[model samples]
Target: MIRFEQVSKSYSGGVQALQKISFHIQPGEMAFLTGHSGAGKSTLLKLISIMERPSAGHVFINGHDLSKVNRKQIPFVRRDIGMIFQNHRLLRDNTIFDNVALPLVIEGYGLKAIRKRVETALDKVGLLDKARYYPNMLSGGEQQRVGIARAVVNTPPILLADEPTGNLDPKLSLEIMRLFEDFNSVGTSVLIATHDLGLIARMKYRTLTLTRGRMVQDGLEASGANGVES
Candidate 1:
């Protein structure tokens, strides 16, 4: 779960990226966050991941107030969250298996444990067969799948994705969304920030709309899980 209480963020250059934002994402929920470029969508995700902090107001992630989060505890806070970028930030030097296994390796898990979890994560993304391939050897979709695998290898409670489907085709985008839904089905909170309106229209999850750094909407649509609202 994540909560933002009247949060606002401004860069050092005096650019205000978010303003008075407030919302709550419950556990086991998957939602789309839609907005144009510079609408504060990325800023919001960064706040949850603690990559950036708000200049005002408070941010609480899974019940810990980030305003009170100490330097020593930032890593622990991040341990409970996972994130995917549009660029599929995989290591070029590592194979798919190594990429997904990186987190567990950093956590100092045993080889047997790392293998079990990495394979499971790769399986969840339907990329287990490609585990031996390097990132450069894969297509955009495959690379993104590897990115998703890395994000979930630790079984984090929340997943933050920024424009995950931006580079994929319609069909592939749907496949990626389906994978995300499967993860949410088992209790991982997912918040995806995207500008692809066409794809978003097909994902009927509760969506929070933002414009000009303001949150404009957050609720369910009448048309079940594939509804769209402009």
Candidate 2:
């Protein structure tokens, strides 16, 4: 569902975040992105979400070319993508129900529809009982799950998570990853950007490794292959 062809992203003053990165993630596929601190994983996700335009080459979601998308068209394109961040990014003052309902509300869904969708998303994340609770009342894992629910409330076809498990313990991390697996099983394409090598090794999914802003490895661990490195 995501294709990047010779994509490069350079900021002002000659700071390059990505250098000619090319990769395609098929629909319903689940993959992990791993790299060092400055390897451009975040930048790559931003480009896909159209938060930043490419300096060169192209980024395509489904069959839509992002470079050709105008500013007015960006929101429409984003409706198909759900984004999760390391920090939950919830509103401190909002209840869980309100938080999860934000996307649908923004999309102008009716009150009845928003309530149903928000509850369904909360149920998926095992947070339905906490719907009336504020984010501050939840544990770290629960808070992150709330973030997940908020992201998926719109039922977007593609999900992109950036360091999603960074703040959780290994057990909580596994729980969170399993939730992503569950979503992937139902045909939502999942791309997770994480630095957890041990977790990646255990999960045995296809992994894309980056180094110095370039893709260095793309391999499936189940086959014991190190994949191509450039």
- TM for candidate 2 is 0.95
List the pairs of residues colliding in candidate 1.
204-225
Give per-residue CA lDDT, model 1, range 1-230, as digits (tens): 89999999999998989999999999998998887788889999998878898999999877879989877878878878888999999999989999999888888999999999999999888889999999999999999999999999999999989999999999999999998998899999999998887776777788888777777778754223232334
Superposed Cα deviation of residue 37, candidate 2 (Å): 0.9
Q: Report every candidate's CA lDDT.
A: 0.87, 0.91
lDDT, model 2: 0.91
* TM-scores of all candidate predictions against the true structure: 0.94, 0.95
Q: What lDDT does candidate 1 reach at residue 155?
A: 94
Q: For candidate 1, give the lDDT.
A: 0.87
Q: Which tens-of-lDDT digit does each residue in 12-108 have in candidate 2?
A: 9998899999999999999999887788999999999999999999999998899999999999888889899999899999999999999898899
Q: Distance (Å) between predicted and true CA of 172, model 2? A: 0.1
Lowest lDDT sum, 10 consecutive residues, model 1, at 221-230
Highest TM-score model number: 2
